[model samples]
Target: MARIAQESPGAPHILIVGGGYVGMYTALRLQKKLRRELRRGEVRVTIVDPNSYMTYQPFLPEAAAGNISPRHVVVPLRRVLPKCTVRKARVTELNHDEGWAIVQPLAGPPERISYDYLVMAAGAVPRLLPIPGLAEHGISLKTVGEAIHLRNHVLEQLEIAESTDDAELRRKALTFVFVGGGFAGVEAVAELEDMTRDATKYMRKVTPQDLRFILVEAAGRILPEVGPDMGKWTAEQLRGRGIDVKMNTLLESAVDGRIELSDGSSFQAGTLVWNAGVKAAPVVRRGGLPVDEKGRVKGTEYLTIEGLVRAFTAGDNAAIPDLTQEGMYCPPNAQHAVRQAKLLGDNIVRSLRGKTLKPYVHSNVGAVAGLGLHKGVAQTYGFKVKGWPAWFMHRTYHGAKVPTFNRKLRVVADWTLALFLKRETVSLATIEQPRADFQLAALDDVRPKERAADQAREPAA
Candidate 1:
């Protein structure tokens, strides 16, 4: 068992699990608000997550489309929460009743960590269904790494299609399919299609007409985050750009590169991007905490786990009661995550000082999504905007909310540079398998040596 480093032996220790919006923002707030307590060893905050950085998911589509630099879309936890103890690990189990958790570090065996307070901000994971070949063929877009890989993959497919002499191979390579039509799926397909169209201009064999982009959704309409009218308009705009918007359709199967849709449609696509949905992290279920049917930790209006003491949760992992609406919980989105984090930090500080905890309450601000360059949809405070204005709103809102002036400046600079310069379409697919070349070279050298040794061992003819 490791104590995870506390300055005072008896002082209260806060063990925060996860480094996403909730964990990062909560720790950031604690570090600032409890500066004196942290310095005096009165309270200790320790954060554990597998990654060292927190990725901003809204810009993933843009990053994938080369509109924003992949490096700028993530915030480093160590740099942001200097006052808290950040552990590069994942909590495998928890004993909330005893205030201890089992953490498995990136390279070390599992260790028990005792805490006075536990924050279950472990975030969410891709909600995969039991579909044939889905696991093997489908690519996801939840992390910055995945976003980068998708970008390289999209460009690589174009290269393959352009270079291939076989029409079947070319057709398959040029066809891109995206499952799910929510914000992530719609934006990803739209942005990538836009980028691909621009990329085709630079290719001699590949034209914009030669490429195909298809969006599959199980719902009746796309962009349910916005108003139905706006969603319809967005769908229409997408179709106008030559995209195949197949609503009320599901990806029944994706065996190898063959796609089978629920609507009796079939096709061969080289790229299959899956953005179906996400559920709370599995750790929340394993922790023995009170979780809802969907595996999210049941949170009180105060943002603490129900029927538990000194244990808190919010964000996608918590089904926190929405004070603004009857019988409704806060939606799993960045807006609530950021807002709840502030209150969660304050409540924790109040609890330490024997003050009454305040409940978290916030109204829906609205929703905004970008559909490629100069195209978007937004519904803020009841006002709906589309096209260029909505796109501008999407950038402005996310740009301001992306945390830290450094990242904001970098994102804005990327947008600024895009206005004057042509989008860079170079594909660095080799980065995914960086050691492949080195391994092949080593194998070649060993092959000759092995051949010589075999010849030397054989009897003379």
Candidate 2:
């Protein structure tokens, strides 16, 4: 099949198994460092991923709320890594002994890919619990499609509320519950709330007071990484905005349209976004490498697979210990991922040149989290900052870390334009059911109603 490309002759072929922060950055660094070697056919690099683009997940909430254009958040693989071959495929399995990996490409049969050097950067996926009906109704904002879907869904609910007299359904649709209170959950809910509140000016039926925004966290604190005082202030700020901050509350079950919580609250809500945690990609498990207690591959300070020195692993899928923090593994955050990738790239080249590899050890600078417009909480260098300063810090730090200059410029431009323009609240939630209207029209001759009683109490547009 066209999916199977033969390795270049007489060159050391490098295979990158994922196109996430670790995969893209590692390959990007390698191509830059080994450009002359690659041109002379001394080294060949192939980057295989399911998608041709790398998503900047930190900007996803802004994208979902239309604070930033979605296009600006993803860097196309072909554009940045021109010297490296980017293949659109999922690494289904790996064979370290055979020195080849199995790739399942879209629209073709699976094939085996050979390589002299292997980089396992297959990141993590959203962890799902066995909660009932979640698989069917719960929406995720992990990818570009997911973010766009969320944006459209939120706006559609507003439209539905404006057009319908069915108060119960409207209420259900407008009520949004976020399962986790960590970064993704908090950022997503806050940005969405900010956008929806702004959009309420256009709707008579749906007021800012009508929307129910719930932030559910099982732990005692919402932003534990941030200090106690700042975290409490964040909760208070959320409360000031009329968000239901439910800490130490557990979601017992969610099936059909009903939800039951461990706090003994039961209700019906149409929109649910789960951002609780994540699990390592399945590709890492099938790769036949050394993984730790968790499903991540165990890597040395050099990010070399536990015992296999040539193969490297990083990002969320690698269980590299935080040697500084006793009995603790590195928390799978982007801060660590990018740093590990940088080291992984440097170590790979050093190993080839018969140079000593450096150990992976970093003293965490602290954490920063954005909680909607001009509201954030952060902890850095043993100091806490909240409100505007924290929010600014959040943007500044992420702007600096968001990969290539092209992407950085695009993101900065998005933020710059956002300063002057209002957020876009037009959600195309109906896209989820593009054919539902057609089916209804064919079967029952039914179309969506969007009318309200006027002066004469007659149906008016």
Candidate 3:
């Protein structure tokens, strides 16, 4: 048994793990519903996460394309959950039977936290395959860091292509390959392509015809959430922009910046972005909870673990039954995660008060995807829309759902600013290692002094 932290007297402590959509939304609802209890010290809410903020993942593509600032895409947890205790830590082990969880703080040793109620909302991570050299060459867009890196890397590649005189080198530098055709992959490629197109006007040598964009998907279609017709139309739109969409094709290898596709085709490219899919965060399994075949924690429609009382889960980590779709579980997406979190919060409160718990049943609110600025595809209320109107809807819908008025205002301000100012394409890659120059100069200074002192000491020789 783990050594657990002492709990506050006369209060029911609620421990929420992960600070993503489910964690933030659940804590927000709890704060509102249990306001009296919280103020009176009758209840305590604590949230633990590795990041101090929750990233609005939907805006990541826009951030990558410089359409939105990276800082604005993430909401600081403490600011949003001021009523709750926010710990910058990772939940390493969970022993629900003992009513304690092992939390490894960002700077300190692991400690045990005891709770009357536990919620597992730890989100998913990028699912990477064992394709040769993928781990070395492929970039991901799942996090803000990756998005920023991709933006810098793509711009840097453009610079390289422009400066190079060799045809082979320029061709390799200008070629961009993206794997997976899901929302993330599609949006990331489209947004970056748009940025690249706009950036070329500033470069003397790089032209629109010189750049090549290729999207590879192993499945027969892309954007299946928007139905077959919309998916087809979206593909057509992408192809019209000179994007090569390869369906039913797999990336066989990416060894040493050389790409080999399943269709017996190969090429050299400087950039490779992988956005295939996501799997439940590893913390879920470490918590000792029962998981389904897909490695998701198994929970009832009420978002409660079957054998674990006072324990609930939602978001990408939980496998909750979908009543609307027979014999199916909820799809791991932002829409479901957000709704499930609200319901889970209410259900937890209901359970505490001996009230009837409501089942988590929510039909998806259709799908919307942006294929770069002023271009998008969306399906809502059984109506299909595409082009500028769809793009507008996509931005409007996500802007509304991004959480917090401050962040919403900032996002809107970004879009508003984009109307008047040119898109900022200057790559600030040096930010990654800002201290490198200073450190190198300091080392050089010390080395020369040391060498002169050694020469004086060896005057006789």
lDDT against the true structure, each candidate: 0.93, 0.85, 0.93
TM-scores, in order shown? 0.97, 0.92, 0.97
| Full-model lDDT, candidate 1 | 0.93
Tens-place lDDT digits, model 3, residues 1-461 = 44556778868899999999999999999999999999888999999999989999999999999999999999999998888999998899988998888988876568888889999999898888889999999998988999999999999999998888999999899999999998998999899999999999999999988889999999999988898999999999999999999999999899999999999989999999998988999998899998988888999999998778999999888899999999999988899999999999999999889999999998887999999999999998899999999999999999999999999999999999999999999999889899999999999999999999999899594
Candidate 3 regions exceeding 4 Å error are 1-6, 450-461
Q: Encode model 1's per-residue lDDT on 98-170: one tens digit a residue.
A: 8888888887567887899988999999999998999998899999999999999999999998898999999
Give the per-residue lDDT of model 2 (tens digit) for 286-338: 88888877788888767888888589888888888787898777888888888
lDDT (Cα, 0-100) at 290 in candidate 3: 87
- Winner on lDDT between 2 and 3 is 3
Best by TM-score: 1
**Regions more than 4 Å wrong, model 2:** 1-4, 430-461
